[model samples]
Target: MPSLDDQPAASDLHHAVLAWYDMHARDLPWRRPEASAWSVMVSEFMLQQTPVARVLPVHEAWLERWPTPADLAAEPTGEAVRAWGRLGYPRRALRLHAAAVAITEQHDGVVPDSYDDLIALPGVGDYTAAAIASFAYGRRHVVLDTNVRRVFARAVAGVEFPATAVTRAERDLATGLLPDEEATAATWAVAVMELGALVCTASSPRCGACPIADVCRWRLAGHPAYDGPPRKAQAWAGTDRQCRGRLMAVLRESEGPVHASALAAAWDDAVQRERCLVGLIDDALVVRVGPESYALP
Candidate 1:
């Protein structure tokens, strides 16, 4: 593990990253110069544990409907949940809606410019907060996501892979690598993340096209294979998560509230279906409209 104090100068790396990004960065909607802070924040939340390709259309449609925090805040939570579509984790939509409400009520209906204030919002974790603060507000923050972490681990620490999650050491190192100019550092953060996503992938990395391949410590260290345990694949069909999504989708598409029978018909397993509904209700993703009817909160 390389300490922050021992890391290489970030200027050269920053330039290299920016150069690569200028040529190869994808034209993501959130990264557009005209995109609002709320749009960037929404993209960050939706991109969590989900791919950019899958998030693109959903993000566009969402922005088209609710361009501002106030717009989303004015709508019912059910709309947000229903608009979430098959994004796997429906809870993110609920959290995002809550965050929008917080922004509307607390932050003058504008996404906060400070990292602390952004992170303080409901469901805004370190990654989302840093991303929004840096990408949207041009604040000097070390945007450390999974992709960024992997890039740093391989390039700086010479590790085959990153730890299970981000750590303090990782944050410190990332901070060290940030450029002197805040805007440039923010752009570099996104560029590095994009590089990891496009070229230095988890599976078969296209090292031939990598900009920092020459400086990659992992590659210079004989390109050793990752020795960790094989990643376990989670099943989607018949799972509680799937059942919960199905139930929420029905409620989201409904105008008022959905009947218990309508929700029950979504899943075949009665026990799993009921548990999913209860879990969603407990999580505040769904609310009881009547004695036996449920709708998204």
Candidate 2:
């Protein structure tokens, strides 16, 4: 593990990054003070492996239709799937709906403020629990998303990219760098994330614009290319995921159950289409309404 003493002073990095965030952070609705805890939770779920620009409109519509956890929980789970639109990962929609039901039933329609309570909810993992606690409730906790991890890897560990999965060393580094004060730590967490998203991006980072560029160990050591195990790009075309998506689109478009023939027409390969349909049914993203029909569940 890299010694915490070896990294740049937390205060200096916090000041620079927080100041930059105050001036340049995107005016996202979820970040607004008026945003409810439910809003933050919704944004967290939608923003997973998805970009902000793509989430904006869908988020707005989602909140407009189902402003509270109770509202979402009251509707059919299938409705949630329908509203998910072309977000690619439809399972997230199912998970979000399940979370809403759990929150409405257990949390009194309120998103929990504590990490323990939040994590107990369906679909809320460790990172999501920490994020909801920190960002939504202004609690002191380490919020280590992919962006934050990358920022830490470069600025503290002098690495071009972090390991495929977060390491225990990385967690310790983040915990050490965290500000003691609750509110400051919350802002610092998001500030680092914003910096990573806007400046220290994965493909092409804008080092000149980065606030902590001067002290970044990666830059100080001369920016090196990632030489770890080969990173595989996500395949989309003709994959099971793509086939599932096409089948889902047909289900989402129809108000009533779609006949098996319609779903067959959506995809070319009959065997692959059948496989995707069965998988979707097993996932509960699609329900077998009839012998020859399917619908969003």
Which candidate number would show the highest TM-score if scored against the true structure?
A: 2
lDDT of 1 by residue, 224-287 (tens): 8887776569898777777877887787677887889998788888888888888888998889
What TM-score does model 2 achieve against the real structure?
A: 0.97
Candidate 2 off by > 4 Å: 1-6
Q: TM-score per candidate, in order?
A: 0.91, 0.97
TM-score, structure 1 vs. true: 0.91
Cα shift from native, residue 228, model 1 (Å): 3.3
Question: How many backbone clashes does every candidate have?
Answer: 0, 0
Report the Cα lDDT for candidate 2.
Answer: 0.92
lDDT of 1: 0.86
lDDT per residue for candidate 2 within 1-297, as digits (tens), equals 233346788888989999999999999999998999999999999998889999999999999999999999999889999999988688889999999999988888889899999998877898999999999999999999999999999998888999999899999999999999999999999999999999999978999999998788888878988888988988989999999989999999998999989998899999999998899989999999888988888
Q: What's the lDDT for all of these models?
A: 0.86, 0.92
Considering summed lDDT, which 10 consecutive residues are worst modelled in model 2? 1-10
